[model samples]
Target: MFVWHGRLYVVRQVLNSWSERVPWWRSTVQPDPPVGAVPERGDHRVWRVEASPGRALGTATYDLACVPPPPLAGHLRPTWTLIRVAD
Candidate 1:
């Protein structure tokens, strides 16, 4: 979920979610993805939104497992912010 302008929106679920292999040559990680920590390709979610004025619509991935309370609230509801995730 995220906020735009002054309105709020929620991502009920990812629709056309997909992922690409992390380019090992381009990657800076000391260790590459162990086996298959992430998916190679597939469409993710097509967020369901309640439209906002100045808000810029886009997609972001999140790992709810690490973030704590307050920050997590944004995901559970709508806000004018983006949830950053590393894949």
Candidate 2:
């Protein structure tokens, strides 16, 4: 789930999702990996999704990347960052 312009949106479909080799702490953004992609020592996972703004209105595509929790923070659930949006 995510909020945009005061509207909460929910993912309706996963258009694509993959894991990559880059560390989540790095500021660099790599190009998306192929579908069903796998990486050695992968550290980042991104998901491209179609979401609706909570009311069955038009949908938008959202690219979200998982921000892994700190080491030993197993009690903490991972969070996601909103990377892109398109109608």
Candidate 3:
């Protein structure tokens, strides 16, 4: 569930989804570790979902991402973000 432009939108279906590896070596984003933790597996998982704002004509597609915590870091939780919306 989410709100876009003051209208509430509920995710009705997930059309597609995938994961993208985070190139930490090529970017300034540093992986959190205790100095000897194994390298992270990859980056966030992306999801393409179809949502509706209570109307059939108001249906739209949106992209969401969920970033998992680093390896061995059980104290942290995955973070979700709304990446984009298709018109």
Q: What TM-score does candidate 2 get on C-alpha atoms?
A: 0.65
RMSD of each: 11.6, 9.0, 5.2
Which candidate number maximizes lDDT?
A: 3
For model 2, which pairs clash? none
Question: How well does candidate 3 match the true structure in TM-score terms?
Answer: 0.64
lDDT of 1 by residue, 1-87 (tens): 455445554554453332234355545545555762442222222222232233476544432211122433444432122324432
Model 2's number of clashes is 0
Instruction: Please provide, for model 3 over 1-87, each residue's C-alpha lDDT reduced to its tens digit, 9 standing for 90 to 100.
Output: 777779788999999999877776744566465665444556789999999888666778999888887766898777677889897
**Which candidate wins on TM-score?**
2
Please list the residue runs of candidate 3 whose C-alpha ends up more than 4 Å from where it truly belongs after superposition. 4-7, 23-26, 29-42
Worst 10 residues of 2 by lDDT: 33-42
Error of 2 at 86 (Å): 1.7
- By TM-score, highest first, what's the ranking? 2, 3, 1
Q: Judging by TM-score, tell me the better candidate of 2 and 3.
A: 2
lDDT at 77 for candidate 3?
78
